[model samples]
Target chain A: MKLRESVIDKSIVQNFLVDAVRKFSPYCPGDLSMATPLIRTGIVDSLTIMEVTKYIESCINTSLPVAKINRESFRTLEALSDMLFDFIKEHNLDLDIDGLKGMG
Target chain B: MDNLGQVLERSINLYPDDVALICSGEQVTYAQLGERVAQFASYFSGLGLNKGDSVAIASFKSIDVVSVMQAALRVDLVYVSLDPRFPPERLKELIRDAAVSVVVLDEFLSQEWSKLEFLPDCIQYALTLHDEKKLEIKSDVKCHNFKEINSDSNDYKRFVPQRKGEDLAYLLYTSGSTGKPKGVRITHDNALAFVEWAASEFEFSQDEHFLNHAQLSFDLSVLDLYNAFLAGARVTLLPEDDAMFFSYVVNLIRDDQITNLYMVPSGIIGLMDKGALMKEAMPKLKRILFAGEKFPVTRLKALLDWVEPNQEVYNLYGPIETNVCTFSKIKTDIVFRSECPIGEAISNAQVALRQDNGIISYDGEGEIVVSGRCVSPGYLNSPILNKSKFFLQDNHRWYCTGDYGYFDKNKVLWLKGRKDNLIKIRGYRIELDEIESHVQDTELVDDVVAVFHGSNSESGAIVLWCVFNQQALDSYGSIDIVVNLIRQKLKSVLPHFMLPKLIKSVKELPKTNRGKVDRLKLKERGI
Candidate 1:
């Protein structure tokens, strides 16, 4: 019943996160950094968060537990990607890096 | 008893010590709220404002703004709610169109107000709330601070004017297809009908803590504000900044123990995405109502699973022209085929489907025609719009809702789509909403919007813009894979001609100010 951890490329995950932020966050500045606070800076509202979360789940192929969708997890692009990576590691799910690029 | 002012007065008399409103950490009892309303009324009277005159209020949602609105109602003045977020030019246009004689606004908006080049000739004075210091205005209009007016001991009993049922209560300006905002004139009776029906339908009581989520300018606030007063229920106003934050909103609801909640589908989806319902049980939350736009079935199912078993959910349907005319209760037993039904008409409204042949149909598709006490008088000062939108047929004044729908076998009304949104692609009639609903049903997609490009002739093509679900993207591992999956799913339900000519994957769809999908913007992008 146990699932094996799937190998994921960190660069691919970072690239996907960048694309999601650029497409979903309309008000987001062009030079948005990985450490930027999307909600606090008004770059993204609740709707954008939903879209971003959905995009993340699709890339990783897993449903995020309610507990992982807090403010800390969604603080920035780095934080969100790290959380997804952690989820992938914990659940032992496989990541498809080439497939992730097509999504981006 | 015919207007909101009377409702507030009744609530004060019935529950003087009960909390009437909580805004920005300030809780006001019914008695205190009444006194402040009276004080504002007296101040307005001192400034020579008379019955039937328009008073424009441009401020954030707060206790002072609520008091000013009630004060205008008490003095029989037409209160015009203006969104302060609007640019100066748009605000000036609305103020000019409303022919407002006075304006009550927050000091924070002083800079923007001063930038306005044109001021309505009727606007003689401006009252600034929140700041004790006087504001320096560049115009000839006189400005007064709230402290100066509130401290006056003048009796307000004599200032209360007798208002008829047909008298103008408020003017709400909504964006029209013509790219201009048209004000909708709602009368005392027009609002009272909806308020009265909602109070009884929801079975609201004095202890009900209702959440005011919509902006004051939006007509949805009519239900949030007046319905609570009609039943002597406490209203908890969500500030504009905090309303944008999902976690903050959930915390507010849990902390305040809000009993009744009203919001648009997008707001509800945001809460669901952030695990608002799953994190903790909102035990005090009794009724959750959504309106303004359609709620995707997948999201609604998630919400239903998250809430308590006994809690009630409703899908209310109506345009700004008529305050909620039809409502559908989201019962646990009812099965949703695609979208939730708009249900039956309210107590004071009648809904009928009018076919293309100018006849009413019970079980087929047609434009929803609403006739009854809740229908508004018509658009303010727009005779052309009034003539086209409002008509008298068979001795009944009916407002033609541009939305298309039909009554099911069980007599429940189901909205199909907007009449204007229907497109003819290569001589094939296609409903944009129908395509969207089918695409949304796909497990791989989170949201979908179908728009038509080009003329109605054979040259036109349909474009399907979709946002893929994270889980699906993860499983498929590529955008091409997700798109292929969606195309395959859509192929079974749609014909070859009805299939999308171009499928574009987007991160998110643009939304209008009222929170509905911004199709006009999508078309403008020519994607």
Candidate 2:
């Protein structure tokens, strides 16, 4: 199934962060936030980043350009949501950009 | 000292006309190679070279380099094959670290080394000819024609006879989390054990022609060179240039009928991208071994679809410290999956999951530890690393692989990811902390995190997440510029195998509550 931003909102990403932190990392969901760090706090790793990239790509139904594959684009749930929205808009991509924007 | 020479002598006496080495347009037979190795040993002894000394062989991957390595073994000396592309500073450092007394360089690389600060400890330098019409050896260093040194009498005494199992064979230095590279010491017994297992597993034979494309410093070469020799198989060394090497492999497969080929994921990807390897050209390839990195199961399926279904495709996984201890031989009927199974340990090896307390036999998801004859002696001169990594249990020296993996109830080993701050590129181990160190060394860089955005090894790309002091982008010119400087500096010290393919600078590096760089946060931020 194609991945859509509406289907995989900041909550889905946040949930992934929660599960990742609990499973692979030492950090527990003391207080999850949009700006909470996932990797530095030992909640995620570089290998996890590959899985996240794949998850985001499948949800959006388009390739994520290398330029957008960095920390700022992945800073937080809000940051990732906005970046996906912008990515969908820039390529005239196949997604609901306005809906994604409002959700962000 | 005479053990290697005696083996070659015996092989030559039995199979004089058997093919020894296959280069682009040259193929040397066993008898001729035996004479050449013996002649060089005589020349070295004539110059008063003794056992336990180090010799530096600087050249690209070619038949000459293989001959030099065998000759070094004949004399019971550890040979460090310095990558020709290494800057003089790195080369000199390795030469000094290994305490090399002699050097044999290709004519082209010799010109580059001539410009370096020649150490007082080195006694002689010989220049090996690449093309015909050899150039004169350098005047500053006691020079010998490496190729023509074989003209000496074949009646020669072997220099060292006590080539024990504990004798040091080679030194392969890898990037450490700390700045300096750490040498992994491989002994003769450990190397021979791995080679013996590999030779039997591949069913290598005197009739099979094996391709040796990996660099000498890589552990894969141990399987390629020594394993092939153990089976009396002809080894065709692939050149270093990408295009030339790929084209050459195609021709070698078609012309030489190479029966066995082992390569990194990227190497196979390049061939598949060019569509250069046709079924007709690779008909004799009984086995295609991929190791050092994972090949996507989809790509492996495509390759299998391209060739005969019965042609074995094996995915091998082993930390270099353990000499490729576990391997998964893909079945033709098995459908492809995204996650490749690393398979079970080799016959002589045992793999177990160790807890934080170092006890073995955790059920799921723990640090992978290997114990066998295949395991390395330890990191050279790093007692601290030895204390942390090498442990004794049940009268066996166990190597902490630092990789996270678990075994299914069926005993199939599945690798998860590394527990350390490192990544494997083309089978060469690189510490991610090493890259962060370079990034942090840049001007106005407060903190940084290097993340592996590329999922598979074939892609060979990484994106760096950076946080700067007041948008230092203008000073560094661009993110690529800062990356280029790091590459330039690293290239001088580390080989190309360690360089990152891409870089991305961000306003801030995402950090966890602990204040360390948060890699998952960087992923979420899309940095």
Candidate 3:
């Protein structure tokens, strides 16, 4: 059976996000709960913002326009996932795995 | 050396037609340059200018500016650069502090500021060419064409210096931390010490072509300009815009066969970003030296990987008070997350660590104090500061450099950070530098800054401000992942309270006039 829409396992997305953060920020680690304020607390300066935004756009298979990139979507992981999902769904995507998996 | 005039005469006798001064497209040979300076020196003397008097040279870094500076020196007068970019208030203050007797400015800036009356200290004001007609009525001060003065008296002679060493050559002011600027009375001996050291240390050949990028007001420019003169090497003074352009720099190096490059980290990074070396910009480039700020390890590593292994990269460190005091040469292969060691002190200089209690030691982290011929006499007119900071200890005067660092067992000096940058947050004292260290350590993060802010209710408690890496976010889009990474890293080294309550990533860190990270502006903008 084809994996139904909304049947996504978030574990894959979460783990990939962690690895990506670790690779980009070698000085900092990749745990999500602890790094919630990466944007809010002033950890991600402008140079890192552009770099991370480009990376996120490529992974989600969508062009993240500069205008859409704001504090709301960049504030947290949950917000970013929702933004990415909506961005994908607007194009009439078939599935939204528990917010992860199968992309790589 | 008292032999400056003699050397000039010798150079004129030998390389009469060799290119000496090149401003824009205009070129003047050694003989012409020598003649021009002597003529100008005599012209100033004919006007009754005395030794020890201050003459303000307010112009861009052109050949004329260099000629005027040398003329002032030859006539035994101190040459002060009236930087056009300096704030009016600072300029006025410097005019008063230095007791400047004459002011020389170019045409463009003179029109905008010709009417503003300087303080009573400045007695004469003259405009360089093109502004001669702008001033409707001139004061009692004598004004003459800088160019005409040189061409008029080819046979003019100057009364060369009878006294040499302790006589004040020029007053280079510190960047002014405590509201009032402090002038460092750099003697002839002090300037010559660094010039002689660099000329010998670099093995400056007669064939080497040099580039002068820094402003004359900056002490670093002294090394660039004088080192060239010391070696009798040809120097090309780069425009500010051209120095900032990677393509232009590459072209200049390749076409001019520029053999030596002494610049700040920004210039180096710009060239790297433009892939200047990827196209083989300068096949003849041999030396690369960067100073003023810590060179980013990531950018430096990539630059080293791209450039020739034989091309030397020297990390030169020193405060304005000491002229290029310490140097650490890095091998192309060495990679460091933190700042490279300031290296061992240069020849004839001694760097020692002084703790709060004032014990000089070699090992422990403390204030990096320098005691040697390189030390400035102290601030002019500020006796209190001179008494406190610049003190005679063990029969020698030492300038207490506020920077904090320690010497390794191998005798290499590693700077930790600034001592004055400590902040108290919620009863926990934290060095703002510690946050910077963490930021630099993070690979995903290109730039990070931690600023101390106070809550609306509390007056002194600290609020944390941060900016993260943009490149990482584009690839990962995981804010939680980055925060978690930083939190985990800090959890082991920093206490729980030290963790920033708010994490906000921005596009860039604000920089001040000196290209240093500005926290005050960040606080004003908020997260």
Candidate 4:
């Protein structure tokens, strides 16, 4: 049996995450790097995280599993996007890149 | 007898060993808490602070903070709760307004004290709550550590000053519509009436572990702290950092077996959105009380379905001027018309609706006016506001609540909107809340805010800002699609004049410090 290789576009995921953060947290200053801590830097607290997660789930067309809905998965833009990509690959869900680009 | 200090003293005598406070992984029994208050009271007496004096507390919620508050009341001093989150300038403004002589602050905020402009002249003594560092004191101010104060011997006879029900107990500053914070003067009687009613209505007992999630500065915390202490129940103060993370708060609730919770609607909504309540069956949660803002019926229903069927839920309503004058037990079989009705007045309060013609009505919509012991003594040092908001009618003092509501035939109060929220467009008056209610009722939206833009004339237009739910967003891929759906939905339900001219989709609605929608900020962002 041969294992299938996974092909993920990092830029697409980064763009989506950045746009979502900006939309949810309009008061967040300057640019948010992929490694920037969302909670530590006060970009999103418990209240605003709800909006960010909801937007991500809507874009991905999948609800995050109960276990994945936690601080670890949402610590940073990179962490969240990586989790989303992993979930997509595990579930073998189709990603409509064009649709997401237009939405962002 | 109506003094808050007497209530604490009675609880200490009745339940000495019972846990009174739980914070920072430590428990303080009623006996220990009482002792701490006594030591602090004795120390204040040594400093010549007596009845009617003001003590400002600028710190996070903790056992020490509550002890100091109780001690101030014990010594007949008015305790002022200030938010540590505020800047030094704002704190100075409040301290000057209250004429605070002594300030108790957390050690973490000691550095910010240097930035204060009025502290040099206004503050006579500074007591640090946490750290024991021999620190620099500016303005020749006397500073004391918390440990030393608590360990100080009460060898000298301490005089507990006599106080009346009308004596000021606390001063809480609330943001006003006029761009300044107004201090609401609450007397011993004003708080006692509400606390007494809550203890009876909620059936508070020592077995209940209540969660204190509100900031110490917010009036909602007043109910949580006093009601728990008065009933000899354990109050678990959720740390400031823990409150910012939903999972942490959920874990704390589960670990502590928190039986009672009092929060604003936004706090409850945030927990619900994180699927906190849905994750497990909180059998220990006996009751959940939400106040300070409107509870959307959809979210309330979701919460009811998530929690245990037998658990009680209450929707309370009151401004800071009159702390929680009305409450409604959200019955399982209850139906909502637009939003949840704020319900009837509490036992100690009387609710009346007055029309524009100065006539009180029972069944029609009018301004909500509350009377009785729950009403505060009026705004502190704000005579213009006092003259307008507080009134004497039939030998009774009534507070104009600024909220418009009507009493249904069932004697229940249904809130319409704020009186100032009324907007005139093209010579027609429209309630902004009514439009927002219709928008929230639409299946596509989770929350909605309707704001009037431009001058209140023929040129003024109504703008509707909405946040679509996950389902709606997933179904409709773009903002244009969501806007079109909402516009169509509103067109069918609203009249031509009530229809919103602009439909905007926001990721989230801006919220005020009290967690209500910041309508002022929305208005500033014109159409």
Fraction of native Cα contacts reproduced by each candidate: 0.10, 0.00, 0.00, 0.14
- Arrange candidates by TM-score, highest first: which order? 2, 4, 1, 3
What DockQ class does candidate 3 belong to?
incorrect
lDDT of 2 by residue, B1-527 (tens): 12433444555666778888876567888877766676666666676766867778877766667777777777777777766665565666677767777777776676665565554456465656463434344345676665555555654344444575777777776777866677777777777677667867887777888888777777777777776666677888765542223444576677878888888876777566532676887878888898887777777777777668657889888877778888888886664445678888888788889887777873677888999887888987679988999899978788898888887777787888788778776566778887677666665467767776556664545566656545666776776665556555654565544555455667676667998778877666553
- Which digits, one per residue and each the tens of the lDDT, describe model 4 over residues B90-146? 577788888888998887567567444446367788888887774345677788876
For model 3, the superposed segments whose C-alpha errors exceed 4 Å read A1-104, B2-14, B117-120, B127-140, B147-152, B155-159, B274-279, B335-337, B421-526
Candidate number with the higher lDDT (1 or 2): 1
Winner on TM-score (1 vs 3): 1
TM-scores of chain B, in order: 0.80, 0.89, 0.77, 0.80
**In order, what lDDT does every prediction score?**
0.77, 0.67, 0.64, 0.76
**Total backbone collisions, model 4:** 0
Q: Which candidate number has the best TM-score?
A: 2
lDDT of 3 by residue, A1-101 (tens): 22232544545444445554543432243335623644422344233344455566556545665445655555555665566556555554333222223
Lowest summed-lDDT stretch of 10 residues in model 4 chain B?
B150-159
**Candidate 3 vs candidate 4, DockQ winner:** 4
Error of 2 at B298 (Å): 1.4
TM-score of chain A of each: 0.78, 0.59, 0.60, 0.78
Worst 10-residue lDDT window for candidate 3 chain B reads: B455-464
